[model samples]
Target chain A: MQQDAARLKVTHEGDIVQVEFTSRKILDEANIAEIGDQLSALVEAEHRPRLVISFAGVDHLSSAALGTLITINNKVKNRDGQLRLCNINPQIFEVFLITKLNTLFHIYPTIKEALESLRSGAQTGRLQ
Target chain B: MRPVFARVVTGTLMKHLKLQAGSRGRRESREKSVGLWCSEEFPSQMAEGRRVEEKILSQCRKYAYGQRDLFALKLALEEAICNAIRHGNKSTPNKHVRVKYRITRERIDVMVEDEGSGFDPAVLPDPTADQNLERACGRGVLLMRAYMNNVVFNSVGNSVMLTKFNESYSSSDTPINSTTVAFG
Candidate 1:
């Protein structure tokens, strides 16, 4: 499993791959690269395209992490897979709003919500 | 009559010492401004930028800065430092990037300097524009300005200074309620 190679907790709900973060602080440079690489590798796995990265354990992340997310999103799209994120801290949530990345990614309020939405294949505008 | 003269001399010296003590007090306040600095050599193999960001965030938290303000400071500091290493120094191990910050009760100020020749901040394309929306590289400068209260570039553009004001902080020898901060 790609999650075995990095600091992510990989779970599965039907076809959805839930990658929960295990770190309280994801702002470290090496950790950012590790998470990005792990997620990127997951995206390349055959027959496993849908992803939901849970940020419940993460208090905050660096801007380089943001760039990593963007790169991973691009890679997922190229593979015809979808990626979603959820459980972001309020401070990090504000960062997403500031960078307009909220528009670029499907951000749910919780892991359950993200899984449910992705499972239902519903495209909703959660950003306002 | 001699005793009176001695008393007068003693009073004069005490007054002069008080004056000197007052000036010293003023200088002490100036010195009380807290500062942190880090330097990274070019061609650095590690992501030192992330570690620096974490350090700034920890300092802000220790000072009881509001969560929103801390987030802004974190974003601005990270962008500035990374820009120094990646763009200004061009990741050349031969050059270097230096970061410094001063935090007071009223505000926090930071500076990031790089060894490379600077570019004009005005000439950079607007990252928020439609054509630039898909691009990943240009948002660092934009985020720094958006999150910081003040962003100033030095002549030649090799360095930047960022400042943010705080309404909830009080810098005193005895802080009344420093533990009551909301960290979000």
Candidate 2:
């Protein structure tokens, strides 16, 4: 099967992979699935892959997108990697609060903060 | 590839009309105050679903729904339509999902129904539970309920109704609170 077009813009800042969504809305199931696959591949390609996903330009996200994030977080954890999410707007952040996912993932207000936390090995604990 | 037509009143509105007349006999009822109503059915495909969603959002823009309201409706509508397509219809190409909505100055009410044997929403596992937090699914209904003012599931569960009051509309008589209710 042909691969779907990449929905993420990924950059490498040292060992940490910085990812941003190319679309304003990450609610489409196919797109979310493709993004999950792409992120999973990135995690599988390296040892202890450190990832930072930024929701800077994103305006809306569905529960499916959140599910994909959880899956990616689990994959990173299984590989002994770290993942940090940042740049989430208030509306999207409300989703995390409502779902109680705010406690599960490491969230930061900006990419610089996320990078700093990753480098300092802070907020690495996962909810059991 | 069903043709979508906006600006038409729906049967649901007529039912509301009767209820309002019998209850309060008032001219300011929601059914009589609607600015636009859209009812359409689309094939069980994500692309088709998205097209309908955009059309509805465009109609909402005409009413000047704020960015926050638009964001919440978009998120909730996506979840409802996705559930109708994937879980309710099992993504069968021949099946269809019916979407009906009414937009008023105060709120937007939407209904999405699919052609499949429905499951009980009560049986859904809580995605927020510690053991289930890492699971990759079952959060759609939760998000819909959280963002919308009210979410209702029909007895069979093949259909869902979502409503969100405009931020500026501060009427204390909200028909339903921000929670999931089961209706026949």
Best by DockQ: 2
Model 1 interface CAPRI class = acceptable
Worst 10 residues of 1 chain A by lDDT: A119-128
Candidate 1 per-residue lDDT over residues A33-105, each given as its tens digit: 7888888877888354998888896877767788888888888878877888888878788778777788788
lDDT of 1 by residue, B113-184 (tens): 888899999999986666765565678888888888778888789988887866566556432222111111
Model 2: residues with Cα > 4 Å off, grouped in runs: A1-5, A124-128, B1-16, B28-37, B170-184
Q: Which pairs of residues collide in model 1?
A: B42-B92, B42-B93, B43-B92, B43-B93
Fraction of true A-B contacts recovered by candidate 1: 0.23
DockQ, in order, for the candidates?
0.39, 0.80
Candidate 2: interface RMSD equals 0.9
For model 2 chain B, where is the 10-residue window of minimal lDDT?
B174-183
Evaluate model 1: give its lDDT. 0.69
